[model samples]
Structures are given as structure tokens and as C-alpha cells.
Target: MKEMTKKIAVLGAGSWGSILASVLVENGNQVMLWTNSEEQAKELNEKHTNEHYIHDYTYPKELITTLDLKEAVTGADFVLFAIPTKVIRPVAQQLLEVLKELSIKPILIHASKGLELGTHKRLSQVITEEIPEEYRSGMVVFSGPSHAEEVANKDITLITAASQNLDNARAVQKIFMNKYLRIYTNTDVIGVEVGGAFKNIIAIGAGILHGLKYGDDAKAALMTRGLAEISRLGVALGADPSTFMGLSGVGDLIVTCTSVHSRNWRCGNQLGEGKKLDDIIQNMGMVIEGINTCKAAYELGNQLNLTLPICHAMYNVLYNDADIQEEIEKLMTRPGKSEIEKYDEC
Candidate 1:
């Protein structure tokens, strides 16, 4: 049996981070749940609860929460980064300060999605740059059809653990899977990342449909076609086509797109309801990844010169103040073409 005495540092103490922390504690590992706020750390360390981010959820009494970066990651076998995508670079930069001082190298697992906007760098690329070169490959992405709320409630869910190394992928799979969570291992890091990474863009579009009071068939078609666009981009990025069909790909897209609890979906719905982009973001105190993804995907789409009509429409609506109804009408009148292209005829 694999050793279970590992110390795992989970950054971001959100619902997803808390759920995973609970699982690690259950697995006989020492868990350090890190937070940016000292107040949140107090609640988590003293009350065994994270009422702010994860409502009605109580962490294990033994689970440690700290504001100190060095303390949170000290001697841990793995560092789980569940921070928001936009904050990833800044947070990783801060971690470098701690790492440079103490010099500990543990496997860094990122559960965040959404590509970096200006850099157009994948999350993996960002992580590699953050960690030292010799330890660069010690990275993993925990991705799949995981909804944080459901995970906090101990719901049975599936996720894919991906790394460049097959052995490391299996190790990550074994570490993350619990009775309530099933973990699969994969080697297609880019495909797995992009599958979970890019689907938020489409999920926002799904929410827009709900706000528009569209029929279920309309939503389903959008999701299917949206997946096609994502697959196209992923292929161009050197991701395996088959990865788009796996748990992290279509599975995650379906759940994120359909669920009312999805922040991205909710953000899109609010936009579709005619709220201003700035207003929607201001009201949504939580991180809605789709908006960030929209910016990055739009910029990246232009960089790659790829045709992503759905993304383009959403970007225009979110950033350019384009009329949602008008954009939908425009998409409806788009030129006809095969849904499955020769490039990615899967």
C-alpha cells in the first residue's frame, strides 16, 4: 500500500479545497489548509468550519488552517493550489518567496482553471515557471466534473488526475480518490487541462440560454457545438483529441454548463438578463471563471486565428457590450458547415 502519512498543503480553503482536505484527513494524511485571510484561518482552525466560502460545511477538527505561507507548506509532500485562475500568477509569485527561503519541493497540484489572459499561458505553464527548474515536472492538475458544493456534501463524483509522468499520474490518482470521489489517471496533461480549463467559456453560454428562456434542445445544441470549438482549440494546442471525450472533457462541460450552482453559469445568466458586465462581476463576490476564460480565450483565439463563434459571441457580450439577443441572432444566422470538421473529425 502507498504511504498515507503524507503532509498535504491545500491552498485556497474554498469548498473544493475544504472537501479535498476532508478527504486527505480521512486518508490518514496531515493536512494544512491555507488561506489568505487570517480571519478565515481563525474560523477554520478554531471552529473547524469555513462558513464564509463553504456554507454549512465543517472541516475536520485536526485540519490545520494558517495564513503563513511557510507554515502552510512546510515539509508537505504536496501543495494543492485551488486559488482562482486570475490570482494564480500573483499567488505563485508569493509562494516563490517562501520557497526561496525554505527550499522545499513538493508536488504542486493545481485545481484551478481558466487560461492566463495576457500571457495566454496554460495553468501548467504558469506552475512550471513558478517552481524551480529541477522540480518543474512535479506538477499535477486535479480536474473533472467536480462541482464544489456537491463535493462538500460528500457526493459521489469523478475526477481525472493528470501528469506528464505515468507513475506520478497513478500516485496522484491514488492520493486524491476517496470513497466519495473516484479518480482516474491520464497522461494527456494539455488535453485534460484544456478540457476542464476551456469548458467554463461554454458553460457561461449555457447560462445565457437559461436566462433567455430557451428550450432544453437549444441548450444541448450549444453545449455540443461549444465542445467542438473547445476541441478545435485543444487540438491546435497539441492536446490529444481523445482527451476531449474523457471525464475532464465532456463530463466536466456537461456538469458545469447545466448546474445552477455553477458560478460561471450564474454569471452568464445575469449577463443574459441584461445586467452590465461590471455590475455582474461586482455582485458576484465569488470567482466566476468564465469571464476570465472569455478574455483569455478571446485573446488566444485571435493569436491562433481559430474560429470560435460561440466564444466570440460571449466575449463581445461580456467585454464589448454587444447585445446578447443580437449576438444570439447572429450566431443563429452563422454560415452552415459540418459540425465535425476534418481537422477534428472525432
Candidate 2:
């Protein structure tokens, strides 16, 4: 059977978004990449490169770039969001108006990770709330351990496409899977989202451990306990515990924590080296999602009465200017408990 080509509109022309749009185009799909910057759009259209985000790489010439959201999404079969979590709601609101005006229903998928700052809602929840049911086919979260740089370099990578609707998940899997990239279908949307979002927090901690010149033993312990915190918060929020063992869970946690490509880990490393959070963020020139996510997780943990020590520690370091060494000492000196006394508490 011949594969049918579909039109994909990818919002946000950042590193991940541009790379994903290129992947879609390479898979024989018509892709329209939407960017807020007219300069970016012009450069992408003419030069076929996004130098600011992904340097020394060329995008597919067939991939289209547009400054107008409506123009990009007008006839797209899928509207994939690759923007930051902070801007998702506003962009979705804009999308809602466009979808209404056009009277077109496209499957909405988000490649972004992290919960909303004030509401602590998942990206999926934010999108669902902004875009009415009548304006979209279904919602899907595309996430896993893959990084933009690796994916752009054509490195072998695997990811999960998650949705409540099995058919929708399968459809996304079929669309995105190629030789260089593999896609798995998962129906546990909550688990996938939670795991994806929470892993960034642990990654930052891992970076801090490395920055402090901690040995493998300490880093290993941090990752294990961090996973515990993630799984506990996820389970409390209605995610499947076993999902943490999957690609979106432990898989993502390992990569983000260990990789040099991870912004969160890098941010944490700088904090470990005694740099101020505000200064580090200003220098990095990219959004460090884990910082904001740690804030959300801290507030959420208190509200749910969950003991998220690592998250709280990260929150203190990032927001409250708490001493990193003191926080580490605090975590180590805490009263002990059995490794698996309770499944939920773990």
C-alpha cells in the first residue's frame, strides 16, 4: 500500500520544532513551520537554516516557513506544538480562533514538556482547555528520551506517542516512524506527560551532583531517588506506576540527567558551581525548563502533601537562593525509611 502524504503544521521554529518539521518533510509529508519571528521565517525560507538554535545544520528545502499562524495551519492534518510550556496557552488560544474561523479540525499534538507555572496543569491539559473539542480531532503528547541535536544529526532515536485514544496514538506512530527514528504507541498519556516533565527536575539535580564533583555512587543514588519522587508524584496524579519504567519515564530520566545536551542538567551544574540562577539563565540563551518545573512541582507537592524532597531542594536552590551544599546535606541527613515500605510513598 502506498503511504498517503499529510500536511503538518509545526508551531515554534526552535531547535526541536525545526528539526521535527524537517523530519516530517523527509518522511514525504508537506510541512509548514510557523515562527513568531519574521526574520526567522525569512531565513528559513531562503537559507534553509536555523542558525540561532541548531547551528551548522541545513533544513530540508521542501519544508515551508511562515510567519502567519493561520497560513501554516489552514489545511494541516496535524498541528504539532514544539513551543515552550510558558507560551502554550496563549498560542493555543490563537490556534483556537484560527480553527474556528477556518472550521477545520486537525489532530493536535504537543512535543513540549512541563506543567503550567501557576496552574501546575500538564501541557495537554492547557491545550485541551484552550482549544475546544469541536476544533480538534484528538490530543496527543509526543515525547521520550530523544534530543533535538541528536535527532537533527540523524542519530538513532526512539520516542513515544501517547494519547487516550489508541487509534490516535497509532496514527502518530505511523506518521513519525522512520529508519532513523522509531516511534512507540502508548495509551498512558498521564504517565508519559508526568514522566517527561518530571525527568527534567532530576536531570538538573544530576548536573548539580556532577558540578559538585560527586562520584558515580552519589549520582546513581540521586537518579534512583529522583525517580522515586517522580513516580510518587505521577502516581498521585493518576499516572501508571509501571510507565516510569518505560521510555517516557526512566528512559527520559537517564538521558536528561546524563547528557551534555540537556539544558536542565547544565543549569543544575552551574548552580552546583555556585553561580546565580538568574545570571546562568541569562547567559544560556535558551529556556531552562527544569527551573520553572521545579517551582511547579514544589507548589504541587505541598498542595498534595507529598514529600518531594528533591523537588523542594531544587526549588530552594533555584527560587529561594538556598545554599547547594546545605541542601545536599539536608537531603542526606534526613531520617531513614525502608526502600519499599509503600508503593505510593516510594
Candidate 3:
């Protein structure tokens, strides 16, 4: 079957967003890369470079950069949001207005990971609430163990396109699949989103372990237990327990926790090295999603009466200014139980 070209408006000109936009352009899509920064738009339009995010990478010349939300989304077949989770609602609201004004219904997709701050809602839920059903065709989440730096370099990468609507997920999979990038379709949106969001918290813990000079034993243990915590929360929130074992779940956790490219892991490494969170964030110049995710998951766990020790520890360290060593000690001293016991309960 001949592939149909899509007009996609990719909101957010950050690393991941820029890379995905370029990929869409390469795939023969009419891609619009949107950024709030007029200067960034000018640079991308003129130089085909987004230096602040992905350095030394040239974007496809066919990719267009836009500052006008209305201009980007008008007649777009798909609106792919790659912005931070915290700003999802506001952006969705803004997008909603533009969609309404233009009288167009675009399929909404999000590549961002992280739960909403105060509501502890998944990013999909937030977008759904903000964008009325009449104004959109469907919703899909793009996630898995993907890093912008690797994808920018055209390294082999695999990711999932998830939605309750299986057809929509498959559609996304077809649009994104290429020789260097493979896309899988999954119907478990809840599990995929939960897994994708929660893994950042674990990645931070992994980075903390690394910065503290802990051996592989500790790193392995942290990741295992972290998966358990993720499964617990996901199950409580109506996600399939099996999804935690898939690409968006364990796959994402493993990569984010171990990779130096992970913003969350790098932030935790700095924290473990005795740097202040504010200072680390300032230096990093990008969102460290784990810090916010840790807080959201900590609260969500409490509400669900779930014990997320790793998330709780991260929360204390990030929000309470609690000592990292003390937090680790506390986690280590917790009452012992069979590892499978928690999994069984979840």
C-alpha cells in the first residue's frame, strides 16, 4: 500500500521534539516544528540547527519552524506534543482554541513523559481533559527507551506507539517506522504511559547510586525494585501488570537509568555529588523530569496506599532536602519480604 503523507505539527523545539520533527520530514511528512522562542524558530528555519538542544546536528531542510500555534496546527493531520508534562494542559488548552478556530480535528499524540504535577494524572489524561472530544480524532502516546541524542545520530532505536484505539496506534507505527527507527504498536495506553512516566523516577535513583560510587549490584537491585514500584503504581491505576515488562516499562527504565544522556539520571548524579538541585538544574539547562515525577509518584503512591520506597526516597531527597545517604540507609533498612510477594500483590 502506498503511504499517505501527514501534516504534523510538532509542538516543542527541544531535543526530542526537534529530532522527531526531522524524522517526520525525512519520512515524507509535511512537518511543522513549533517553538515559543522566536529566536529558536529563526535559527531552525535559517540554519537547520537547534544548537541549544541537539548540537552539531542538521535538521531536514524541508522541516518548517513556526512560532504561531494557529499556523502550525491549521489543517494538520496530527498534532504531536513533545513539550514537558507540566505545561501540557496549558498548551493543550491553547491548541484547543486554535483547533476550534480552524475547525480542524487532528489526532493528538504526546512524546513527553512525566505525570502532571498536582493532579498526578497521566499526560494523556491531562491532554484529553484540555482538548474536548469533538475537536480531536484520537489520542496516542509515543514512548519507550528512546533518547534524543541517539536518535539524532540516526542510531538504531525502537519505541512504542500506544493508544486505547489500536488502529490509531498502528497508524502511528507505520508513519514512524524506518530502517534506523522501528516502531511498535501497543493498545495498553495506561500501562505504557505509566511505565514511561514512572521510569524517570527510577533513573534518578540509578544515577544517585552511580554518583555515590555504588557497584553494579546496587544498580541492579535499584532497577529491579524500581520496576516493582512502577508496577505497583501502574496496577493500582488500572494498567496491565504485564505491560510493565515491555518496551515502555522495563526497557525505558533500563536505558534511562543507565544512560548519561538521561536528564533525570544526570540530575541525580549531580545531587549525589553534593550539588544543589537548583544549581544542577541551572547547569543542565533542561528539564530533569525525574525530580517532578518523583514528587507526583510519591503523592500518587500515598493516595493509592502503595509503598513506593524508591520514589519516596527520591521525593525526600529532592523536595525535603533530605540527605541522600540517610535516604539510602532508610531504604536499605526496610523490613524484608519476598521480592515476588509485592509483585503478586500488585
Error of 3 at 339 (Å): 1.1
Best by TM-score: 2
Model 1: per-residue lDDT, tens digit, 249-342? 9999999999988988998888778777788888877888888888888888788888888999989988898889899999899878876585
TM-score of each: 0.96, 0.98, 0.98
**Candidate 1 minimal-lDDT segment of 10 residues:** 337-346
**Tens digits of per-residue lDDT for model 3, 134-249:** 99999999999999999988899999999999888988887788999999989889999999999999998888888889999999999999999899889888889999999999
For residue 318, what is the lDDT in candidate 3?
88
User: How many residue pairs clash (N, CA or C atoms closer than 3 angstroms) in each of the candidate models, in the order given?
Assistant: 0, 0, 0
Specify the poorest-scoring 10-residue window by lDDT in model 3.
Answer: 337-346
lDDT of each: 0.85, 0.93, 0.91
TM-score winner, 1 or 3: 3
Which stretches in model 2 have alpha-carbon errors above 4 Å? none
Tens-digit lDDT track for model 2 on 89-116? 9999999999999899999999998999
lDDT of 3 at 83: 98
Stretches of candidate 1 off by over 4 Å are 135-137, 344-346
Q: Pick the candidate with the highest lDDT.
A: 2
Ranking by TM-score: 2, 3, 1
